[model samples]
Target chain A: MLEWTRGQAVGEIDTPALILDIAAAERNIRAMADRLIHGSVRLRPHVKTHKCPLLAHKQMAAGAIGVTAAKLGEAEVMIRAGIPEVLVSTPIVGRTKIDRLLALSRHAIVLTVVDDVGAARAISDAATRVGQKIPVLVDVDVGQRRTGVLPGEPALALARQVATMPGLVLVGLQGYEGHLQHVQSRDEREAHWRASMEKLTDTADLIRGAGFPLDIVSTGGTGTSTFALEAPGITEIQPGSYVVMDDHYGTVQGVGFEQALFVLTTVVSRTRTTDVIVDAGMKALSSDSGPPRVRGIEGAQYVFAGDEHGRIEFADQGSNLRVGDRVLLVPSHCDTTINLHDHYHVIEDDRLVEVWPISARGRIR
Target chain B: MLEWTRGQAVGEIDTPALILDIAAAERNIRAMADRLIHGSVRLRPHVKTHKCPLLAHKQMAAGAIGVTAAKLGEAEVMIRAGIPEVLVSTPIVGRTKIDRLLALSRHAIVLTVVDDVGAARAISDAATRVGQKIPVLVDVDVGQRRTGVLPGEPALALARQVATMPGLVLVGLQGYEGHLQHVQSRDEREAHWRASMEKLTDTADLIRGAGFPLDIVSTGGTGTSTFALEAPGITEIQPGSYVVMDDHYGTVQGVGFEQALFVLTTVVSRTRTTDVIVDAGMKALSSDSGPPRVRGIEGAQYVFAGDEHGRIEFADQGSNLRVGDRVLLVPSHCDTTINLHDHYHVIEDDRLVEVWPISARGRIR
Candidate 1:
C-alpha cells in the first residue's frame, strides 16, 4: 500500500521530514514550461515558494526569465547558488539594507520595487554609492490594499521619481492582486482579477504617459496565473505556488499543477479507534491557511495536535493503522510550510531517492 | 528601550531579529520558580517556546525540575547542552525516531507520553531491545481534543498497558489543557480549567487506585499556569510562553509576562501621510495567531502586506515616523516566529549587546 519510497532505503529519514516527488515535480515543472513556451507572458516564478536554489535552477532551465525573492537574504542564497537573474520583490530601505542591496546589484542583475519617494531615494542613494544604475519598479495598489501607491497619480509620481534618479531605471510597474488569488469561486476570481487588471493597466498607462517607458507590467500568483497572464497590459506573471501545489491549491479548477510536495510524517500513535498522530503540525506546516488535507484519505480530518504533531482521523472506521506508518499530508500554504523545514526528501514511487537541502529555508532577513 | 545580553559582545545588531531580554527572562523564570516553590508542583517549561539551551539553563537555574521538548531533536539539543532531565512532550514514532529516543535515554532522564497501546508497545519493544526501562506517561484528552486518550476508562487502559510492559515504567499521566491557555475571557478560562482539572484529577485517582504509583502528573501552559497549579492532583505545570510573551499572551489576564521578545524591524518605506512598511512579515513573524501588534505605537494597525512585508498605518495626525526608524512588533505566536529565524540578538538600551544562536532553530526531526 505504501508507494512513495517503496524499494528505497527509508532507514535514515528522520520524523517530520518533507518529501518531494521527483516524478511529480518533473511533471509540474514541464507543465509550467509548456505554458511558458506557448504563452507570451515572461515566466518570473517567485522563489519564495520553494526557496531552494537547486529548484530555482530547475525553473530557470525550464525557460523562466528570472526568479523573484521576497527578502534580500533569500536573493543572496539564490545568487550564491549561481542563479542568473533575481529580483528582491520587496522594497529595499534603510541605509544598512540599502548598502546590502547595492552590493548585491554590483554582482547580479537585482531589481526591487518601491511605493514611495523615501524608499526610492534610499535605492537611488545606494545605487549611486555603488556607481551603478539599479532597475526599479513602482508598486501599484491594484486591489490588494497592502503596500504600493494608489494606481493613478501616486503611481505616476513614484515612476517619475525612479526615471529622474541619476542611478535608477524605471523598468516597469509591479502590482499583485493577492486578494483575488485565492477566490474560491471561478466567476468571483475572474471578476476580481478583471477589476484588479483594469487598475494595473491604467497605472501602466499613467507611468508610460509620464515620459517613462515601462518595460514590464508584473503581477499574479499560481492561483490566478492564467487570469493574470491574460490581463491587458501585463508582460510577466509571478506564480510561485504552482511549483509545489498544496491543499489550498488543490481546490483550484484546471490549474494543471500536481500535488508534488508533502510533509511525510510518521504515525506516532494508533489506538482509541483509528486515531493516528503524525509528526507534522503547525511547526512543520503552517495552519495560517487553516488545516491541511490528508492526501488520498477521504472523509478524514487532519486535526492539529501540538506545535509538532498532527492528529489524522482516518476515513475507514477503526482502520488497522499502526505506529511507524508514514503518511503524507498536503500543506495548506506551500511557501510557509517549505520555510519551516531545513531539507526536502526527493521521493519516487515510495522509495527514498535524494534529499535536497532547503538552502534558503529560513532566510527571513 | 532594550536591555540585557546573551553572551559578552556589544554592538549594533542587524535589524529585524528576535531579541531576548535576558534580565526580564530571568525574572519570569524566577517568578515561575517561586510560584512552584515549596510545593508538590515541579516546573518543566516547554522548550518549544524559546528553543534556546541558554534560556533553558536559566529555567533550570530558577528551579525547573526539567525541560519539555516538542521534538526529539530539541530534546537532543538540550541533553547535549548539559540539561540532564528532558521529556519529549510529543509522541515518538517511526523506527528511526524510536532508536534516537532510546539512544537519548541512555544519556539523560528521558520520558515520553503515549495515549495509545500501539505506541506503548513500540516504546516497550524499543526499550526492551536497549535493556532499559523508559518511563511513559499516559496522555489524557483533557478537553483539548487534539491527542491523548479520553480521561476515563480509555486512559486507564493505556496506563495498564504501560504497567504490563517490563521495559516501560508507567510513571504518571500528562493532560495538557491547551484550549484553556488561550481562552480570551478570564472567567471563561478559569471556569474551563476547573472543569478540565476535575476530569484530570478523577483520572489520576482512577489510575492510582488501579495499583500504579504515579510519580508525575503534568498539565498547564503560560496562560493557566497559576490555575493549573491549583488543580487538585497535578504535580507539575508546564508553562513556556511566560518567559517570552508574544502578543498572543497579552490576551491572558494577570499573566505578568512582559512582552520581552520583539522583532526589531526597520522602516523600509515611509509614505507622505506617514504610512510605513517594515522588513518583517509572515517569514519573520507568524500571523497564525493573528496579525502582530506594534509594541509602542498607539493607534496603529499593523496590517500584513505580504509574506515579506508588513504595513504600519499610523494615525495621520501623529506622522513623526520616517525611514530607518526601528519598530518592535510583538509576534502573534512567539514559538512559530522564533522557529523562522536562525539566530537571535540580545539587546540593551538601543544597541545590540549580544547574539544568542538558536542552536535548535530548525530541529524538525
Candidate 2:
C-alpha cells in the first residue's frame, strides 16, 4: 500500500531518522491545553520531555504559564530563544550549574527546587553572590523516592529556611508524583496521587504555618491531571508526556493523549522462514523501558534489537513483507527516544512538510 | 590532580561534562596497535565507538590497517577527512543508504557486509548503477542473534550470489563475537570465541574452497581481542572500546586498557544525613548497562538517579562529601556514555586540555 508519495517513503530516507507528526503534535498540544483550561490547575509544561526551544514556544503559545527544564543548559537555550518564563525543575548542584542558574535568573523568571538545607544554603549563596534574589521551591518527595525531601515537617523546615535566607525567596512547594505517571489503571493512579497530594498539601500547610506564604503548589502528571487540579491547595501541574505520548503513557486508561509519535522505519531485509528486519532498532527507538510495538501490523511481534536492525515477526504470512515497505514503530519511552536523534522530520498526510531540530537533544550539561 | 592546562580547573568546569584523558588516550591507541602487531590479526578499529576523525587518524597512525564504521554517514565523514579505507560494518539496505554506500565507493576503499541475498542484490545494483564494483563480505551470525546470516551454506550461498552479481566483489567472511565482548570472565570469553571462530573459520573455508579469494576475515572485540587474534582464520580484529576503556571493560582481567574516561560532575549540595548529590545522572551517564563505578572511592555507591542528579552514598563515612566537590564517575559503558555527550573535555589530571567534538556522536544514520 503506497499511500504516501514515492519520494516521501521511508525507503527514500536514511536509517535512524526521527519522524514526527506536526498535526498530531498540534493535536496533543491543544489537548493538554484544553484540559488545563477546563480544570483549575495552572500548567507549567516540563520542557525536559521535548528539549527544543521551538516546542517550548509552542507550549507557551498554547496557554502554558511557564516551561520547566531538567537541566540548566536547557533553560539557557530556552531563555536565549526568548522564552521569558522557565523553571529549572531539576536540582541545581555544583558551582558551574549554580552559576548558570544565577545567570539564567538575569535573563528570565527562573525557578529552582531545594530539598535539603545545604542545597538551600548553596542556592542562597549563589543568589547573594549574583546580587539577585531567586525564588526557591521546597521539593517534597511524595512517592518518587528519586529526589526531594520527605513530606511534612522536613519539607516545611526547608521552606522556612529558604524564607529566612538573605537572597532566596521561599515561593512555594513543588512535588512530583512520578510513580503514578505511568500506572496503567487510572483509578489506581488517581488514588496514588490523592494520597501523595495529601502529604504535599500537609507539607504546604506546615510551611504556611511557619510564617511563609506559599504562592505555587505544583504537582501531578498527565495521568493524574484531573485529580491534581481538584486537590486542595494545588495551584499548578507539570505534565510533560501528555504532549508526545509514547506506548507506555498512551496506554494509561482515561488519558486523552494518543500515541502520536512514531519512528518511521523501512523493512530492509527479510528471511523466508524467520521474520522481517526493519532499519530501526535500539539506537532509533530506546529499549531502556521495553520493546516497541509495531503499529497496526496484525499479530506481529517485534523482537531482537541489534545496533541498527529490528527483527519483526508476523503471526502468519511473513512472506507478505518485502524491502522498501514502511513500518511505524511505537517507541517504548518517548523522552529517551527523542534524545537519540538530531532532528524530527515533521510529516503530514504522507508528505514531507517540515523538519524541527531537537535543538537541545544532547544538552547533558 | 591538577595536571593538564587547556583552560580552567576541573572544579571550575561545568557539571556533566565528558572528561577524556589525552595521555591515557594516546597510550590506549598505541596499546591496541601494539597488541595487534604482536598478534596475527590486523587491527581495524571501529570508529563508531569514538566517532571522531582525529581519533580514527590516530588509530591508523598507531598501525591500524583500516577503520570500521557502523553507518554510512560516519564513513562519509571519515572518508572526507582522507581516511582511505573503511568498512560499513552494518548491512546496507533501503535505497537511500544503498545509494550513499554506492557513492562512498568512488573515493574510498569501501567495504560492506551482506547477510541476505536480497540486500546483496540491491547493493550490487546500486553499485552497478554508479559504475563501481564495491567489495562485499558475508556477515556470519555467530552467537549474537542481532544480525548476519548463519554460517555454512547460507553464508556460502550469499557469498556465491555476491560473486555472481555485477559490480560486487565477494570478499571473505565477517563474524563478530559480540556476546564475548562483555563476558566478565576471560576464560569463558575465550572459550566462546574459540567455539564461534571455529564455525566462522569453517564458513570461510567453504567460501575459499569454492575458488573465491577470501582476503579479509574480520572479527573480535576488545574483550576477545587476544582470543580472536589466535583464531585460525580471523585475519583482522575490530576493537573499538580499547581507545577509552569504560568501567565495565576495565574490570575484564588481563585487558590492560585503563579507565581513561570519566563524567566530571560537581556536588552542588551536601547533607550530614546523606551522601552528596552531583549534577549528572542518566542523561549524562547511561544506565543501560548498570550504575557507573565511582573511580577510587571505596565503599561508595551511586544511589538514586534523577534526569540530572546522581546521588552518591559512601557507606562508612556517612556523608563525607561537601558542596562544590568534584566527583569523577567511571561510566558503566563507554560507547553509550559517549553518545550522551556533545563534546569530550580532554583532561590529563584535573585541568581541561582540549575539547574534542564527538563529531558523529548521534550518527545512527
Candidate 3:
C-alpha cells in the first residue's frame, strides 16, 4: 500500500503513516557508531526496535559487527535479506523451532541463548543428528529475574554443560540488564548498571576458570551503552533504540539521540472549541508506557479515544487547526509501536522518498 | 505460514498462534442472533473485533443486516470480499480517504459517520464530483467525549446541515456509550445506557421534526447488549466482541458469551521451580486493558516479560510445566489482540480445519 508513496510530496501521503526521517536516522546511526568505534566492545545493535533489514545494513556499515534479534522468525527475515551473522537473543525451545533453527544454521552463523539443561540437550541432539555445531551463549540473569540462570555457580554450570555437548560450542555469556534500561536518573542507572555488570563479569571469569571459552560477553542497550563503555569486560554491545529514539528513551537523563520516528496523523474532527480528534489511536500508536506527545503543535494533549481515533485537546485558541490538517507525534514506546505497522514511510528533505517494509513486524513465533 | 495447518492436528501448530474454536464461535453467533431475532433492533455487528471476512459472512448468515467497520480500509476489505453493505463507524477525513470512500461507494452501500460540518462538506463535495450519493450519519457524543457531536442541539444542527448538502443524505444518529460498556455493575450500566438512549432518541425526533429522515439510531456493544435490547428507539445494535469473548468481557457479570478465542503459546524456558517463560508477550497479546489469563493452566499468573516473551509464575506446583510445554491464554481485549496477528487458526473438534486471513488487521487508515 505504501509502495506508491515514492516520488510524492510528504503532505500528500496518507495519515496514520509510520514515518522515518532519513537524515535524522542516519545521524543517529552515526552517533551510536562513533560512541563505540574506539572501544574494545564491538557493536551488535538489536534488530527488534527497527524491524527493517535496510536499517540493519546501515548500522552494520556504520561499524556494527552483526545484528541481534529477539526471535527465530526475525532472524530468518534478516538472514533472508542477506545479513550474514545473527544472534537470536532469546532461548529457542520446542521441536519445530529447534528443527527450524538447525535448518537455519545451515545458511548462516546462528547463535542462541540457553538457561536450561534439558532444552540444551534437545538442541544438542538435534544438531548432532544434522551434523551442525550451533553456537550458544549461557544466558545469565543478573537481576531482572525474568529469564536466565542465576549468576556465579548456576551460570557456570549451564556453561559447563553447553561446552561438553558434542554439537554445540559455548562461545560467550549474555547477561542483559533490561530492567535498568529506563532508569530516570543517571546515578541510579549507572549504580545498578555497574552492579549488574560486576555479576556478569564475575560469572564470565568463573566459567573461564573452569577451562571454557567465554570470549564474547555481550550486553547493554540504548540507555546504558555509555556505562558499558566504562565497564572493562564486556566485549560487545547491543544498543537498539538509539537509532530511532522515542519519548520514553528521550526522558532518560543522558540519552542525547534525536527523535527520528513519528506517526503522521490527520485531524478528523474539530467538534468543540477545545477538543479535536485525530486518526491515530491505540492501534496506530502504543500506550504501554504513556501517551504520545504532539510534535509541532503547541499546548495540546493527546488521549486515546478508541482503536481508530485519538483526542487532542488544546489549551488556547483550540490549536488553530481545521479538519484534514496533519499532526506528527512521537510514540511512547518505539519497539511496540513499530511492531504494529507494515512499512515505514521514509522522509528525506521533507519529501517522501521510499517505503521500506518492516520485514519482521509480526514475527512473534 | 499457517496454510499448512489446514489439515494438521491442533497440537502441532506453532506457538503464539491465534485460535478460533469453530463450534464455540458458532454457538456464540447463534446465541446473539437468538437474543435479538424477535426484537425490532436488528444486528449489524461491528467487524473491528474479528477482522476476518469469513466471520463477517458468518454473522450475516445468522441474520445480521450488515457489518460495521471502524475504518475505510476495513470497509474496503469487507466490501471487496462480497459483503454488500457496510457502515464505517468513525469519521472519514482528508483528501485521499474521501477519494477512496467515493470509489468504494460505487461497489457497495457505504455509509460513514460525521460530527463536523466541514468534514461533511468535504465528503459531500467529493461525492458530488464523482456523481455519487453517499449516505452520512450524524455521530452524537452521548457521554463519551471521543469523536461525536454533542447530543441535543449540536447533533441536530449537523443533521440539518447534512440534509441540504448535495451528494449526501442525512440517514440517522449514532451514539455509542463507550464509557459505560465495561461497567462492572449491571444496574449502573443500564442506568447510563438508558440515559444515553433517551438523548439519542430525542435528537432523532428533533431532526425528523425539522423535515429530515432520521430513521436509524444505532448503538450497543457486547458489554451492554442486553440493556440495549430493553431500551426503545434504537433501530439496530452494533454489538461486537460477542462472537469471540475475552477476559475483559468475561469479568462483566451479565455478558454471557462463551470464550471462543485464545493464543496458543509454548514455554520457552523453565529455569526456576516457581517460574517459566512463554513465547507470547506484549507483541502476541494486547495489554491495554490488562494481562491475559493462562487457560487450562491453574494458579499461574501471566506477566509480559518483553516484546517476545511472557513470564508465568505458578502458586502451588509452579504450573507442573516443563520446557516446550504448551499453554493457552485468553487475551484481555479481543479487538486489539486480533489486530496483532495475520491469520486465525480455526479449530473444529480439536483439529485445525482452516486458516482465515485477517484481511483488515492493519487497516488503520
Candidate 4:
C-alpha cells in the first residue's frame, strides 16, 4: 500500500518509518514459543501489538493454539485471514458490536469474554437470532480491577447466567493481572502474579463445580506469562508485547526479550549547537509512558518539540548529527506507537528488505 | 471505508468513535475568518489538526489564503482534493521526500520551509532536474530553537543561498514561537510573543534589505496568532487547533475556542465500587500531553487501563454509571488523537447522520 519507500536503500528510507528488526523479532517469537510449547499450557499471542497476520501465523505455526484479539474488529481481521480460532479478549458490550460479534461467529470459532450478565444476555440474544452458539468466558477481577467480575461468587453467578442462555456455551474464565506487568523486581512480580493466579484458578474451580464446562482459563501478559506458566489451571497465556519489546518492558528484570522495533527518523533540522531536531514527535512516536530513547546515542535526550518534530539534546557538545542523517528511537510503549503507523519496514542485518502492512492497525471499533 | 458504523443512531453509535461537533467547528472557522478579513495579515490555517479536506475547503471559502500541511503526504491529499495551494510547513528533507515535493509542484503551489542549506540545495537540485520552480521560506528560530536558523545573519545567508539556486524562489521567512503557546497569563504571553516577533521582523527586514523579494513572512500558531497578527511585518498566520479545541487549550486564559471534538466511549466494565472502565484507552485516546478529560462528568477522573480500556473514578461514591452507558472524552491534543481514527462521525442536532473519511488521517510519511 505504501509505495514511496518500497525499493529504497536503507540510508535513503524516509523519516518516521516504523522499522522492525525482523531477525530480533523472530528470535523473540521463538523464545516465547519455546517457553510455552513444552509446558502444559500454550501461547495465544494477542494481535493488538503487531496487528499483522503474518506474524500471528508464524506464532500459530510454532505452536500457538489461537490468536487473542482485544476487540471484535481485530477478531474479524484475524478470522478473515484464515486464523481458525480467535478469542476476543475484552468484553463486547454495545448493540452494534454484539451484532458484529454474532456475524463473526458465523465464520469462525469466535470466543469472547463477558464481565456482566447484561452484556452476556445481549450477545446471547443476537447469536440466537442468527442460529449460532457462541463460546463465552466469564472475566474475573484478579487484582487489576480495571474490568471483570469479582472472583468467587460474582464470577460464578455470571457463568450460571450464561449457562442458562440458549445460544451460548460456557467455555472458560479470563482473569488478567495487567497491573503486575511492569513490576521491576522479579520476586515482587512473581509474588503478586501468584496471588492473581490463585484467584483465577479458584474462580474457575467454583464455576466448574456449578456444572459448567469450564476448560480454558486464559490470562497473563508478556511480563507475567512466564510466572503464570507455573500456576495450576491456566490453559493459555496471551503475551503480545514480547514479540516487539520496548524500553518499558526491556527494563524489567528477568524478561529475556530484546529491542526489536524502532521508529526510523531523519535529522531534518540541526541548526542548534546543543540539539538536533528530527522528523518524529508525538504524531510519529508516542509519549504515553515517556519520551522515546535514542538508540546507540548515549546520553542523548529526546523531548517532543511539537506534533511533528523531536529535539534530541546530546550530553556532549561535539555531536556530529547533520541533516539527512538517520536516527532510530526506541518506543517507550509499543502498542500505542505501532497503532500510529500504517506499515512496518522490515529490516534484517540493517537492510530494509520488505514492507508489511499493519492490517488492523486502528481497528479500535 | 468504514461501513459498520455508517447508518447507526447517535445513541447507539459504536464506542471509541471520533465525534465532531459541527456547529462549534463552524463557529471556530468563522471567528478566525472575521478577525482576519479586514486586516493585512492573512490566515493560512494548519490542516494537521482536522486532517479533513472538507474542513480545509471551509477555511479557504471563508478567508484563509491557503492551507498549511505538516508533510508532503498531507499536501498530496489536499491537492488531490482540488485545493489550489498548500504550504508544507515542516522542512522536506531526504531524496524520497524531495521527489514527492517536486511531483506536488507539478499540480499545485506546494511551498515548503527549510533551515539547512544542504537541505535547500537537495530540494533545489531535484526541482531543477524536473524543471519546476518551487516556492520556499527560510525558517528562522525566534525562541523555540526546535528548528530554523538563528533569526539574524544565519537566516539571511540561507535566503541568499536559496536565491542563487536554479529552480527555487525565496519567498519569505518563518519564525514560530511554539514554546510560548501555553503561557497562562495573557500579558506574559503577549510580552514573550512580542520579543519573538521582534527577532522575526528584524530578520525579515534584513533579508528584504538585500536585493531579495521577501514578500510573505509566515508564522504563529493557535496560541499566539492574535499577538502575531498585531506585528507589522507578519504577512500571514498559521493556527491549527482553533478549529477543534481540546482540554489542553481549553484551560488557557484568553483563547475563545470551545470544545468541538470528543472520543465517544461506552462503559463496558463497571465492577469496582471505586472505578468503572470504559472502552477508550491509550489506543483510542492519546496520553502524550495528559489523559483525556471526561467531557461532562463533573468529578470523574480518567486513567488509561490498557490498550483498549479506560478507568473512570468519580469523586462522589454514589455515581450511577452502569454497564453500557455512553461517555464522551475531550482529547488532550487534537492532532495526535485524530490520527488514530479513520473517519469522523459528524454530529448535528444530536444525530449521527454523516460519516466523513479522514483521507489524510495517517499521512505522516
Q: Could you give candidate 2's per-residue lDDT for residues A200-259 as a string of tens digits?
A: 888888878878889999887778875654787898988887777888777788888767
Candidates, DockQ: 0.52, 0.45, 0.79, 0.85
- lDDT score, residue B207, model 3? 84
- Candidate 2's C-alpha runs over 4 A off are A1-7, A317-319, B1-7, B268-276
Better of 1 and 3 by DockQ: 3
Off by over 4 Å in 1: A1-14, A228-232, A314-320, B1-15, B184-188, B228-232, B270-275, B314-318
Residues B1-365, model 4: lDDT tens digits: 25544446666778789999888899999998887777799999999989999999999999888999998888999999989999998898888788788877888899999899889999898888888878999999999878899999989999999999998899998888889888878789889999999999999999888878888999888888767557799999999999998888987778878788999999998887878899998888888778999977889999888889999999987889989999999999898899899988998877887888888987887
- lDDT of candidate 4 at residue B11, scale 0 to 100: 65
Q: A55-157 in candidate 4: lDDT tens per residue? A: 9998898889999999888888888899999999898997778778887777788998989888889888988887888898898889987889999999988
Which of candidates 2 and 3 is the stronger one according to DockQ? 3
Question: lDDT tens digits, residues A156-261, model 3?
Answer: 8888888889989999999999999999899999999999999999999998998997879989999999776778999998989998899999899997799999
Deviating ranges (above 4 Å) for candidate 3: B2-9
The best candidate in terms of DockQ: 4
TM-score of chain B of 3: 0.98
User: What is the per-residue lDDT of model 2 for residues B14-125, given as tens digits with 9 covering 90 to 100?
Assistant: 7678888888988999988887687778989998778888999999999988899987878988998889999888878777677777767778898988887887888788
In the range B66-146, model 3's lDDT, one tens digit per residue, is: 999999989989999999999999999888888899988989999989998989998899898889998988999888888
Compute each candidate's TM-score over C-alphas. 0.92, 0.94, 0.98, 0.98
lDDT of model 2 at residue A77? 80
Clashing pairs in 4: none
Chain B alone, TM-score, model 4: 0.97
Interface RMSD to the true structure, each candidate: 2.9, 3.2, 1.2, 1.0
* TM-score on B-chain, cand. 2: 0.95
